[model samples]
Every structure is written in structure tokens, then in C-alpha cells.
Target: DAGITQSPRYKITETGRQVTLMCHQTWSHSYMFWYRQDLGHGLRLIYYSAAADITDKGEVPDGYVVSRSKTENFPLTLESATRSQTSVYFCASGAGSLTDTQYFGPGTRLTVL
Candidate 1:
């Protein structure tokens, strides 16, 4: 089973452009998360969802948007992508609650030029 996975393992785009990254899980996990990996910030949360149709902004959601319309999918969009948005984006899933152990995807490396 595909526990949790991400698409377009790698992406490249120009500044001001827009890009969408996809994440999927087969377990119908109750919680899903979006995060970006940077040099200093490390892995910082961008957004998250408690369940289908329920979403919330995380520590860093300024240049990104996310939606979870179904239990097994969560996608993130970089609206008007910026150079600083260049980072390895990761999608994670947790079975029970926010504090539960989360499994991470392989990650999508996005480059902005």
C-alpha cells in the first residue's frame, strides 16, 4: 500500500509563477500536514488538516495554500511562487490526533529561478 506519497518529486519554475504539489495516502489518516525544508528553519509546518474538509494554517503559510477535500489526499499550492519558496516540500500523515506519530513522504524539491 502507498502509505503516504508526493508527486512531481522535483519541480522548477520562475518567480511569480504558480505551482501545485500533490500528496496522497492510502490509510485515510485523520491528520495531514504540509511542510518546507530550508537551511536554517529546518522542517517548518506550512499548513495542516484535521480531517476531510477541515484545514488550518501552520507556522509558515504566507506564500502557500493547502486543501484537503478528501481523507486520502492533500495538496499544496504556491500561489505566485517566489524564489524564497524554493525548498524541499514534504507531506505527512498521522492516524489519530495532531500529537500522533506522523509518516512523511519522499518529498518534492521545488526550485525557483
Candidate 2:
């Protein structure tokens, strides 16, 4: 098991609904990232934060939002959930550029019907 884990491993919501996926890591890292895996899109970065209170949008951040308040906690929110946004979401944390390794959480499978 990883030190990092995502809450509500599985979730089902209706279109236009709002959903939030929680992520927590035991190993405190300066950087945390959120990614979504889709059929054709593969895995795309949604958001990332370099440190507490410093976050930036990633490849796909139009329909989603993320916040990093503390070093070990990062949460992602879907402002207006949609069917097309259905995908497996992953949360990861990494040390500085030295390790070049990211510990990933299990992943949250969300279905928007």
C-alpha cells in the first residue's frame, strides 16, 4: 500500500453535479499533482502545486479545480461535473528533482451519468 490514498475510491454522480476527490500523503512533499486517465487522452495532468498555497493549472483544468493548502494534502474539485469528465483520477506526490519518482495513490474512479 502507498502512503498516499484517495478517498471514495468509487463515486457516481449526475451531470452538472459537483464532486470532490480527496488526497492525502504521509510523505510530505513540496509538489503534488492531479491527473486523469481517459481512453484516447491517456493520462493528462489536471493540476499541480509546488508548495503550500501555490498551485497552477495543468493540461486540462477547464472543468476542474484543485487546491493545496498544506504540504501533504491536495484536493481536487469538479466545479460542474459532466459526462465527458468521467475518468480515473490519480493523486501523486514527489520529492525535488533529485528522486525523479512520484508516489501515486490508488486512484478514484468517477462516473458521471
Candidate 3:
């Protein structure tokens, strides 16, 4: 009730299907980010929003889409999920200050078959 939360904690879908992962934060942080964690690799940023209505692509942006029309919600969509998209997705929020800490959601594990 006081932190970030992600929906569909686990999912299994076929290739080419569209998948949307939801993230909501209770702190109303100004900065939100989407990251992907694959086996044997660190988390890779897929997208980020500095504030509501302002978003930017990160390290890996292809095949993914994001929107932030509200400050507390950031939704990540896989336009066409592929096997390569199988991984754990994380949603995080920060206070937008240098010293502020980033809070992360539990994470959503997506498997594309």
C-alpha cells in the first residue's frame, strides 16, 4: 500500500502477441523507468519518463512502447513480443533529485513462446 506495484507478476504468451505490463507507484515520484533483466545480464533500460507526458527511449527501445499520461502510472507495452523479449521486467520510480533513491516494483516475469 506504500510502494510500487506491478501487475501480471508472471505471464506466458506466444510470439507476435502484444503484452502490456503495468506499474503504479504510491509516492508520486517524478521519474519512472522500465528495465529488462535477462539471464546472465544486468538490467537494461527500455524506457524512462522524466515527468508526466515526457518520455525517452533508453538502452533498448525497439519493439517496446511506453506512455505516462499520469505521474503515478507508467505502462510498458511490447508491440509484438518475441522470444527475445522473455525476461523479468521491472518498474522503478525516483524522486527526480540526485540524492533521492529509486524504488522498484516486485517485477513481472514474461515468457514468450
For candidate 2, give the lDDT.
0.90
lDDT of 3: 0.94
- For model 1, the stretches where C-alpha displacement exceeds 4 angstroms are none
Error of 2 at 22 (Å): 0.3
Query: Can you write out model 2's per-residue Cα lDDT over 1-113, one digit (the tens) per residue?
Result: 43998998999999999999999998888888899999898879999888999999988999998888788899999988999899999998998852378878999999999
All-Cα superposition RMSD per candidate: 0.8, 1.8, 1.3
- The alpha-carbon lDDT assigned to residue 33 of candidate 3 equals 92
Tens digits of per-residue lDDT for model 1, 1-113? 76898999999999999899999999988999999999988899999999998999999999888888889999999999999898999999999889889999999999999
TM-score of each: 0.96, 0.93, 0.95
Candidate 3 has which clashing residue pairs, if any? none
Error of 3 at 32 (Å): 0.3
Model 2: what TM-score? 0.93
Which residue window of length 10 is worst by lDDT in model 3?
A: 95-104
